[model samples]
Target chain A: MSADNLTRTQRDDLRTIAAMIVPASDAYKVPGADDPAIQADMLATLGRDTKLVAAALDHLARLAGGPFAELDANRREAVAQEFRKVGGAAAATLVRVVLQCYYRDDRVLRSLGLELRAPFPKGHVLPDGDWSLLDPVKARGGTLRRAP
Target chain B: MKDPVDVLIIGAGASGAAVAWSLAETKMHILCLEQGGWMNPAEYPSTGRDWEAKFYGEWSSSPNVRGRPEDYPINDDNSPIKVVNYNAVGGSTVMYTAHWPRLHPSDFKVKTLDGVADDWPIDYDALTPFFEENDRIMGTSGLSGDPLSPLTHPPMPQQPMGLSGAIVGKAMNKLGWHWWPSDTTVATMDYEGRARCINLGHCTPACAQGAKSSTDITYWPHAIRAGVELRTHCRVREITTDENGMASGVVYYDKDGVEQFQPAHVVIIACNGVGTPRLLLNSKSNRFPNGLANSSGLVGKNLMFHPYAQIYGYVEEPTDSNRAPPTCLWSKEWYDTDLSRGFVRGYGVQFVRGAGPVFEAVVSEQKGILPWGEDHHRVFRKLNGHRLGFSAICEDLPEEHNQVTLDPVLKDSHGIPAPKIDYTISENSRKMMEHALARGREVLETAGATDICINSPIPWGGWHLLGTARMGTDPNRSVVNEWGRAHDVKNLFIVDGSIFVTSGGVNPTSTIQALALYIADQMKQRLANLFD
Candidate 1:
């Protein structure tokens, strides 16, 4: 998607910003980092770095503080806790703007492990309504599960 | 194929599935035809947090049953059955927002009170038993608060969710308003071997842990076990009737797009509000010219979609907006004949937690309340701990102006013209909204929510479309008889939301399913007497 064609400085700044937005974690590493192999799929999908893409990266990084490469779990969370401290009215607005940009960016989709509006899976095999005829096990009276 | 089945059911959605399930118990030879393929149990989206993405995917991946373009093709204006329906074995049940509330007794006699629309052929009392049966079958998780719903034998097997329910409960209790656990089809326990709802947060597309009781997971299996045949990916085009005006069979496009004849003694059309009317209009035959079951020339008149407004609030506590289940608490506080305040029928107030942080942030950011740069960062900090949202559903009167007609030029993949909708909210609907907003404000005040924002501008579109092919007492006015049978056709039956006389303030699925059951029984008894 070639991110609206970013300048060299803008691209470097965006990479730095993305590094901060998607901080590293032992559970699941951020898509982009010092490792060139990671986030390559996302980068290809999202068109490198557009203005909105750059803004999203910057927003995530500013919230987390320092680049994602440098942050530990505790440090990364401390930054997220700051988001909560700000309250819903303002915080909701910020998240919405960044998500709008991220959702559009192929990189954010890859980072979050998502595609951009793919169709639902096909070839659903509806029961021929002949289960009893097929001698399937009957598990009647099974509507008694506890509500979540 | 030697002796045609008594009833060839098409589309195992709420209406078709329920009708088939009800008939299967009688040991009748039944064959249900569906246009979509089967669903993978493992691929059910509600199983995980990432399932939200399913809403954006292909029609097949869509959490809704009306997933593919072929399943939900509309005319140019997107008016005829404007909404998408699922096509799997369960039909539209898989993606339904499980908000089931019974119609008020007065809803049957709308013309008597509102001076518009005709009275139902059968009153609420007649349908009460079927409603009860529906509650039992669906495992409705409701409270004993509403006197309108007097089901005591089968208690609510499940309890409501935590945060949203509690908030509404507290607010309603404080104000002396009536509230209850929403009547839902989700399994509260491990009923019938289906896993309980793990509260995986996705109820629309697919139940992740098998808690939601969509027909495929619930009734379809039982019906299948009782010797019913469900053929998927077979789209029924029109019913072919004999010279005697009896529906002999249906000509349909099979899943492979081949034209196949599904001959049967009786044909039941439960395709839904939009599809049902379209099928009737399209089934033009030599014996009857104005399409099937539409002798009154009112097949697609009186289309009514419930008008609603979403009132959001910014609260102090962390409401955990990212919890499982899309909708939970419902309020019927104003769902009555409270005309003293100057409205005909009242509305219902349903409270639900707001969207997730990412989704929430995205919404707020679009408002430009948080522009990019440092301003965006500041907004994120604010949304972390926010309590928000209460959606108001106002009742819409049955007005003739709101109608669904076939498009003159535009056609879908099947060479059928799209359904064009000519709709306008009535003056009565405007008043209903005004009353609902005032009550919502009171709840927000009671809950101590700060910076309350009321955003309601006449609902545009939702799947809850109702009241096109209404049931009525007079054959001159209504299209169907007391049992949802065609006034003109002896063998054709229309069971779906289209038969609703008036649009209630709650979700219509429960009532639709109940009506399907009631009609199914009538068909069963009548069909059994073939040799008599």
Candidate 2:
């Protein structure tokens, strides 16, 4: 919603790029990066490095031969592949920000069957694993350094 | 503020806290000054939605990146290794992984055995009792009778190794290597009022459950309860000496940036390797022109950083990698020297879990292993829980050229000269790393891992800063004597990793604490003629 550093078209193009990276499917009803919450997070992260975002978006627009958001799905995919091929700091930053925002969303956690709670206050409990697998290691005696 | 205390400690870190706890038994007034304040568990990153961001932001373990008001940055331009430290009351323990391992018996006599690096003034047997005492106080959890180490019992039960540990253990068995569940300072059950670990998995930035044994919760509370005074946010600028060249007290900047001097009967420097040398070098006077205790001119020389490497791979099965601590299992089979490998000392290998989901996604994308469009999810899922990693902690010998010096231009917030680190990996360490990487690949392959990616020596791996002011018997070659007492100034002592003569192949926290306790005992016995 607060695309302070980005124009309207740039925001839409970024949303499209994020959606292509992690598109919504029926198998896991997770929201794509086009979701409002996810977009806001992505925009905030992108706002930190506005120059990098601007450069990456300009590259995508040139690859698609127009506004990247106006391109079809196939064209968008091709343009994204072109951007990936010409990998630079801007492209890497864009991918990193988009992935960080998408994967940390609550819907993604639910889709992955994980509780959306803080890691502390009520930490996760792991079942006791098989200790017998270490029997062989324990059977081998001490391997101390030999004294001079 | 009130009066000159019986003893003055410069840092409230691991060694300082331990020394305070031990010396409090003598009923002497003990005071400690810490540059950073107490860390509250409630303010930990895990309690927020943006927990992962903390690792890259304010909660970063490196002082160069964290940049708090009290932090002093290190000029690491000349070194391949970067220095990482946390300056709070618990020192680097606040952000450490809590992997506690003692030095081997031969680690004491490195010169006699390997004909390189000076032997420690004190041996492992002499410090065994203190190590055992520290384990009881710090609440370590492990099984007894590790063949690679001397026999010792932990007070708490061991943590679960989970699936990754099982796979790695089986691989070590196949390779006929010595692997064991690493002894950690995390509490399993409620021991000594700290809560049990719930496997939150973020042990580096901060442990919110109060499970990891940072010195603030482990030793500081006990010391404070026994009537020790700890002044937070007070940074010591220089150690002042009397007319006779004996350490009388220190001139420090208080919490409000006010300059003040506190006199004490005995002064102890527990401010780690770099900080200790910086303070000593900054305290230049007419009596000691080069530095305070630099008659030997070795105060900031012979710095050793344990060169580290991490090897990651993808396992075949879908196993849970986010359910346990960061590291719970390690191998010492390659710890000692093997002449055929063309290296002097060896390295320890640890099997650890990968970071959180977000971190993994970033790493995978950056490494070009995961594509951007359409193929992201597939590669992410394939590498999610089905990943394993091994980190090698290689021993770096003492080299006179790799040292800590005062930067002429760089100044901290207090206008003090910043510590300049000049270090490079030795040929011996490079050969050791090569051998360790090959061995790591063999282990991962034997354990049925594919798509293996082995990284070079990690750049941000200078967690264990040691050997700047090495301990020895002769005054001409060393800064401190066998008892951690300065050879030049009788009333001055250093009880941190700075007194280490050699950098061992494991984490240095356990040995640092034990040496602090041992030095405190020596002070108690020689109380009558301490300044003589």
On TM-score, the candidate that comes out on top is: 2
Q: Against the true two-chain complex, what DockQ does each candidate achieve?
A: 0.05, 0.53
- TM-scores vs. true structure, each candidate: 0.78, 0.93
RMSD, candidate 2, Å: 2.9
Model 2 lDDT per residue over B342-415, tens place? 98888887778666777777777767787665565667778877789889999999999999999999998889
Q: What is the C-alpha lDDT of each candidate?
A: 0.63, 0.85
Residue B270, model 1: Cα distance from true site in angstroms: 0.5
Each candidate: fraction of true contacts kept? Answer: 0.04, 0.64
Docking class of 1: incorrect
Which digits, one per residue and each the tens of the lDDT, describe model 1 over residues B1-532? 4368877987788878888888887786789888777777677754333344334344233223233644545542433223545667777777766667777666666667665556677777777888888777766665444443334334454344455555555666677665555667776566666765555555666665666778887788888988989988787778888887888898877767788887897788888777777778878777778778777788888887777766766666555354545566666666766668787776776676655544555555444443443344445445533655677677777877677777777565567655667766677777877777777778877877765666564222356768778887677788888787788777778889999888867777878988898888777677645312
State model 2's lDDT: 0.85
Model 2 bad stretches (over 4 Å)? A1-29, A44-95, A146-148
